[model samples]
Target chain A: MLPKKVKKRASLLTIFLLLSVIGVFLILNALNKNILYFNSPTDIKISQDINYNKKMRVGGMVKKNTLNINDQEIRFIITDFKNEVEVSFKGTIPNLFAEGKGVVAEGKLQDKKFFIAERILAKHDENYMPPELKNIMKENAE
Target chain B: MLNYFYNSNIFTWIEKLTNFINSIFFALLIAGLSFALVFSPPDYLQGDSVRIMYVHVPAAWISLASFSCIALLSIFNFIFKIKHLTLITKSIAPIGLMFTCIAIVTGSIWGRPTWGTFWAWDARISSMLILALFYLAFIFIHKLVSDEDRANKISSIVAAFGLINIPIIKYSVEWWSTLHQPASIKITGSSSIHSSMLMPLLLMFFVLIMYCALIFLMKYKTEIIRIKKKNLKRL
Candidate 1:
């Protein structure tokens, strides 16, 4: 058996280890609580029953016929298989941004379905060349 | 009797002072985390999502700060042959690893809301990922070596090399078109965050620093005891 003094020291060390682990757990929990998260068009539809004031993200492909480009606001429809969301934004659209492409909109919920976007993120595939150009290159080789 | 002898250890004064300092830092950390929770303002753009900055920024900052501690300790160990410095570094590795993981996890969570994706190869994000890996590698190496002297030597060399990643992580956003935002609060820079947001962030940052300080000191104390026990066994 270890001496009483050694046992005391070991117990002290155990307390520190426990505190450190608790500290990390608390930090992670705090982080999860504070950060908002992205949802697909279908996911937003499911979450519509929950609190709407909470900040969130909606992601989908921008529908081809949905973009209404006016002077200041560029409104569009984002759609997943089962649902679609109308997203309105007044900012510089990303370079690769266009119809029939993946886009994620960040902002608030209004009318239970529409998302008022503060920032619109347009996602592009690794190839910078347009899909049409990529097809053309393939066609020429073939 | 036993209590008297234990309390009268050779470094008792140093231990007392370190404990005092550790307590102060621990208090500040708790205060900061709580303040950040209650008082931080909503973002004009991000709304509630802005609060993620409190945890995310501080995690990133302290991960870098721990590396700074490691680098400094590594240099001291190499130059002065200070066994205490190596002990401090070993004590700090796990804490650093935990913080780095927090920063990455929080950053990803925040990104999902802001950038529409959970993961990215953006320069800032990738460099931070590498940093997390470096910390893991350091811990792994520290564990692998059975010899105390050899472990210290190897880990110090690793620490020295890992210091290079710190600058890269800091400057990656500035150098590249990254989804990650630039520094909101720095020693130099006009902060764009409103006063309400700024206060909580500062408070949380202070708390994280204090947390790191407290853990480091506690670990160092444990290390000293461990070394003494080993010496006693030899005797």
Candidate 2:
């Protein structure tokens, strides 16, 4: 028969393991909505009830020749090739923000087709290529 | 190995080494801070406020390293049932918590000037906050549980459970689109930061590591003495 101390240790270990599993499950479940991913134009397009008030990120390539620069606002079109959404912002954009580059705009959706971005993130790759240019390079290499 | 360490003069040697390093750490800290604050050029984007990176980054690094040490010690203690391992883990917790607090506060101070806000629910900051909470839970478990062996068991379990957060914290900036900048130093490639700025940052990192070591050694010595006194009383 196991000693009393040994039995106590075993039971404690079992309880600890059980608690850890439950804790992980609960945390992941709760964080599912908060752990936001960059929604493609298609994802935003297909969704029925778009979140207009909550801040969300939409990521895609800045469409070439669609960028409009004025003294007041900078506007561009973000496309996932299948669908496109117009984005407008007014600020000093990141140095990497250029046409035909991948960008993630963080703000609320104005409607199904328009996004008013509070912050424009210029997404880049490891090799210093803008994400959109990197994809194009890959496609050309193939 | 445990018996050898207990019987030999290793702890005394560690004490002396840490004492020696303590003086060097102070000297380097003053010099590093001067160089970082006065000598280093202001960042183009952040201007003078970027100097806070010298303190915030190193403290964050040390806090993460300390937690990694606690997790590793907990694993060894659980596997081998070594009392010394548990004692060392217990000693490191408070110091680790202090470093985590420094990182957070300094980060917030830095954020106000740069990010225009003290706090955001960004992934990197949130994950770091979670890590600090785990450290708190570890310390609280040790205090609440009266039984020595049981306390060690539960605290070690907590430390091991908290190990999952370290990777999440490290990769949070890259994995999520956060306001926090991506890591300048990459393992496979050379650092992207200029060498002029990198020098003071590296020196400050060394100073913080030495500081943590000196504190850890002192705390571990105190724990050993307390355990010895308790054992004597029991006898």
Candidate 3:
């Protein structure tokens, strides 16, 4: 048999490792339940039984010329190119909210085609190419 | 040999190096702040409010880095039974806690203008709050325990366990839908942030890291001296 002191130390280390593993497992499982996945318009279209009442996120490019801004509400069409969903938000949209930009709207869906966005988040492109370089690329492509 | 290295010249050399770096860091801190606040270009989307990133991002980065260091040091202490490693861990805890606090507060201020709310139960923000709590618990365990050896072991266990939160915080934005933006600075690929804005942000990050190292070294040295004096008294 191992020495009593060595056995005790080994058991202590085992217990600590087991506790850490269990704690991390429980925390990640709990967080997974609460996480809201951002769905593209295509995901929303393909999934037939999406819960309409629960709040969800719909992210896609804002279709060009679909924006309708009135004093009371702002409306736009978010498209994944494969499918499109119309979003209407009453709140003041973010400054980056514009046609053809990427956007994520969070709220309940009135239907598959209609989304009442409680919050509108403008998502910018990750590219940070200089304007002069961008012009050069555009000319080369042309 | 180890005692000679510790006694003869290494400590003096470390002190000199620390002083030199500390002076350079102070100058860089002032210059970086001025450049970040006044000279850097306003964000294309966020405007002047983006200046907050200079402080908030670096604080967040440093706190994560500090916890990672603590976790690694805790492991080394466990394996090698090194007293100095635990001392370093003790010295780092309060500094990490302070940086976590700065990150949270500055993030709240930045969120108010950008996200239109001071706070939200978003994934990224909540994970950061958990990190702050871990730092608090680490310090609390150290304070509550009377025996130095017991305190060190317990706090090290806590620090090792809390290391799980670091990866969660880093990946929270990507894994879940959150108001907080995705990382602007990519590790392997090109950064999303413009070079004009990134330069000042990087400068501030360097200054803050140097500041953390200086404080950690000073605190570690003091702890070592205190321990030595206590041992002498017992003798």
Candidate 4:
């Protein structure tokens, strides 16, 4: 049996910490949209209050075979499997931006179907390996 | 029981521990650096740019871990009313702030090559900036407040509130989409990071932990000395 003072403080801290953790989750749950940094194409399509002229971000995989590039601009379609947004950007994109890879386009929604991107940022998945190991893994999958 | 915390007793032990740590620190740092810079292979996709993870990841870990330590000590001090606990927390704050800054800087440097921008006001990045702000508030509370008791009380509450942000930072990637990638390392379940890269990352993390330990011990020793000097003046 421990002293009451030790026990009291321990219990108090535990309660305080639990409340803080639970409180955060509740607050985050309520303020989910505020905290979410970017919206997927599906989010844009579903949300009712979306402002077309207001600049926003739409992140999703660069749809395969939809990329159409020219000297002045690059056009591609981003998809979340459920929905898709066509994005057109004039600026240079990141090296990692590729078809069938994660990409986040920042700009204005031209309409429900088209987005004018001011900038394109590449998003990578969690996997990390050397080129040789990545090649071996790819070979195994094939 | 109180005698265990006698300043002179703790002070003497601090000296020996600091010296022992100093002797081994350089060797470990050299090994860690060599493995991080030379031995580690380039990323399959990211190539050599991924090497920045050696400093960036460890600093991020240290900053987060240090905040948790400070918050725990603060709670113990408030409950147990232990002056020794306050010393420990106070010693930890600056180190936490330093590493928090390091993590942000190194992360941004790593960002340019990958994210195309040095900074973005995304959830993960913004929350981390808020964390650095919390550290500043914790340190400034102690420095600016004249009454030691009041300072401790205020700082303890501040740390408790700051504790809420820890979970936010950790889950930010998962809770929301951001420019930052999801964590590759995990405490439970399988990690996505390869063993070859993991080795150097762990080595660098160990070296930074040792560095933090050295700084904490030295700062703690000084706090004890300051208390003793104050006591002698009262006589």
Model 2 reaches an interface RMSD of: 7.6
Task: Please list all clashing residue pairs in model 1, or write none if there are none.
Answer: B29-B207
Kindly list the interface RMSD, in angstroms, of each predicted candidate in the order they appear: 15.5, 7.6, 3.9, 2.0
lDDT of 4 by residue, A1-142 (tens): 7679888977887787788788877987998887777799889888899897788888999999999999988999999999999999998888888898888888999888899999999888888898999899889999
Off by over 4 Å in 1: A1-142, B1-34
Q: Which tens-of-lDDT digit does each residue in B1-235 have in candidate 3?
A: 4354245465686699798997798689889989889988776556677889899999999999999999878865654466767777889989999999999999999877665667767788999999999999989988899998888888877887888789889988888766678898878888887787788989999999888888887887888788789989999
For model 1 the local lDDT of residue A79 reads: 84
Which pairs of residues collide in candidate 3?
A: none
Give model 3's TM-score versus the native structure: 0.84
- Residue range B94-181, candidate 1, lDDT tens digits: 8999999999999888767655568865667877888888888878887899887887767776676677678778876555445566
lDDT for predicted candidate 1 compared with the true structure: 0.71
Answer with 1 or 3, whichever has the higher TM-score: 3
Give candidate 2's error at residue A126 in angstroms: 11
Candidate 4 ranges beyond 4 A from true positions: A1-27, B1-7
Best by lDDT: 4
Model 2 CA lDDT for position B140: 93
Alpha-carbon error at A48 in model 4, in Å?
1.7
Shift in Å, residue B163, candidate 3: 1.5
Deviation of model 4 at B194, angstroms: 0.8
Docking level of model 2 = incorrect
lDDT by residue (tens digit), candidate 2, B129-194: 999999999999888999988888778888888887898889887766566667877878887666
Q: Please, what are the lDDT tens digits per residue for candidate 4 over residues B1-235? A: 7667654567678778888989999999999999999999999888898999999999999899999999988987777788878888899999999999999999999888787888888889999999999999999999999999999989998898798899889989987988899999988999999999999999999999999989998888889879889999999
2 versus 3: better DockQ goes to: 3
